[model samples]
Target: MVGPIGNKFAPIGDPGRQAYEDSLQVFEEVIQAACQQVGIEPVRADQIAVAGEITDQVFRHLIEDDVVIADVSGGNPNVMYELGLRHTTGKLTIQIGEFGQLPFDVNTIRTIQFSRSPRGLIDARNQLERALQVGLLEGPDLLAVTRIFREAQEGAADIELSTPDVTVETSDDDAPGLLDTMDDVERRLAAMADNADEIAAAIEIIGAVTESAGSEVQKAAQSGASNSVRLSLVAKYASDIREPVEKLESQSSEFAEHMESINDGVLALLKMIQSSSPEDRPEGWEAFLDQLISMAESSREGMEGLNTFGSAAEGLGSLSRQLRGPGRKINAAVNNMRKAIATIDSWDRAARSIRKPSEV
Candidate 1:
């Protein structure tokens, strides 16, 4: 049961079939098996029986079909057009895409993303089958409605996850594709590490500038320099630290934003884990936990790094307070840490609940 990977043929006057041929072939094999597991016939829209049926026949299926499994590789214009028509219906639509090619329209929607490797093909099939099982249960459509924007003026999409024990809120343009989401987690972790280190270095530069001006400040105070002259001295010192302070604030803001997204992905993942039963874990339970634990640890480290920054920034109390925007970010980072720690604690308890089969 495999159908519509787009009417992708070389002479067909459509360039939508841009997936690596090898991976496409793998998808065909595994998709059929997945369909068979759930007693559904898979059909690819490779052709239209009637001339105008491209609109009439296809439109009927898009609207009337129980579910539509769209492989949106290459963001094929044809597939996208059909997918858009289906979106208006808000029916059961499962979108699958190649890594790094996720589109903005479905950015916030849950998508199955895979690389073009052998294992990746198998993983995509597994995810598809699970999605089918969930959809057939009369659950919400994968593309149920236009995603809600948490910050309307900012136009950012949000994923808010909460359980009795913990709550995590984060915003995304779309999500990091689950498979790609992990890769994104890794990238952001590295970037956060870099940003934190750079901030520490920038702070050192500020400290040096302050110490260098100490003697001059003392001399002016002793000599009873006039108010204007003393103010000029302060201005010169402020100038010396302005560039580094500004840099610190910019990096701090980015750090806060990135940290939120990281926790967002982590919490999104944890919810998925809690939803699945022990008998049917999402992906391989072991591998999933491995990545989850790694991200959690990295986030803790990031939190500590921010704590260190907060302590260091406190030394610049009066000066930084006068520079309002620069100091605002540190507070956000500290607050984000508190939220993330709650998320991690919840995750830790969940992980410990999963015992190995041998141990069980």
Candidate 2:
């Protein structure tokens, strides 16, 4: 088995550098424990002759190994990248991470999440033993593995395929009457509203975490650390920033889904309102009509908001381009701008052509 420790040793300044070293120590102990649990000899770096750095030769050797045990803690980019390479080789690979450190995207993939406590380490080792057993036998379903190896290397138990349940409490007075019936559009719009609320709340939480992380990193930098310490801290800050930003982007995508559902609901509501005769209208039909109109307006507004957020995200893409230097930045910027403009144009068309109930 090959265990890559590139990210654990990656240059981040003083405190973070020390933290990374400590993490590596913990990683080594855990790996040995896990191997013992599985009845395998714990392989050390010196024994395996693997370099700490992520050289192409090291990566090639890892890919050629019979099995891979990767530590994905701290969102280690190089480790993740190599793990991905290992997956492409269609070998047995096991994933583990520090508790709560797994990326949202990778959380669905079965992983052993460890804590600092001895009991936690033992539990993680047990889990890893089970994973290795299964992985050794099955080889990770070659055909079903993700193009992204890290995703593919995820064990079955870790994948989250469905959304969590949303609970909304209503007082007797606020509950709808037994006789009330909602058309598809009204029902869909209500659902979209609930989803939007959830997404908004998630965004707020992620933003708060990102802000706090940034502040901590800034403080660390200001304390006059050594080069290794500073680099490590900066790298960690970058990784920390990446997580919440990714969550925010994902929530934004969910908002887009909400917008689409609302649009569908509005169109459906408009059609229902247009088709119904005065005799067929319910007792509070006028109220329903007013609500439908309001909902349509809200949907349009929500789409605008989503578009704006998307634009801001697109702006971040420009930063990535600029960091890469001149010629590359222009192409990336152009491509990004083109996509942004296209999305805006599509939203413009959607907004302008949304049929009013009266028109329908």
- Provide TM-scores for the models: 0.38, 0.38
Task: Please write out the lDDT profile of model 2 over residues 104-164, one tens digit for every residue.
Answer: 4343344566787878777666666655665666566442234334563664332221212
Q: What's every prediction's RMSD, in angstroms?
A: 24.2, 19.3
Instruction: Quote the positional error of residue 262 for candidate 2 in Å.
Output: 21
lDDT of 1 by residue, 18-96 (tens): 4434335745756677788899976655434556645667778888887887777656676788887777665678777
- Once superposed on the true structure, which residue ranges of model 1 sit more than 4 Å away at CA? 1-27, 47-52, 142-360
Ten contiguous residues minimizing lDDT sum, candidate 1: 141-150
- Cα lDDT over the full model 2: 0.50
Q: Give the Cα error of residue 187 in candidate 1, in Å.
A: 30
Q: Give the Cα error of residue 76 in candidate 1, in Å.
A: 1.4
Supply the TM-score for candidate 2.
0.38
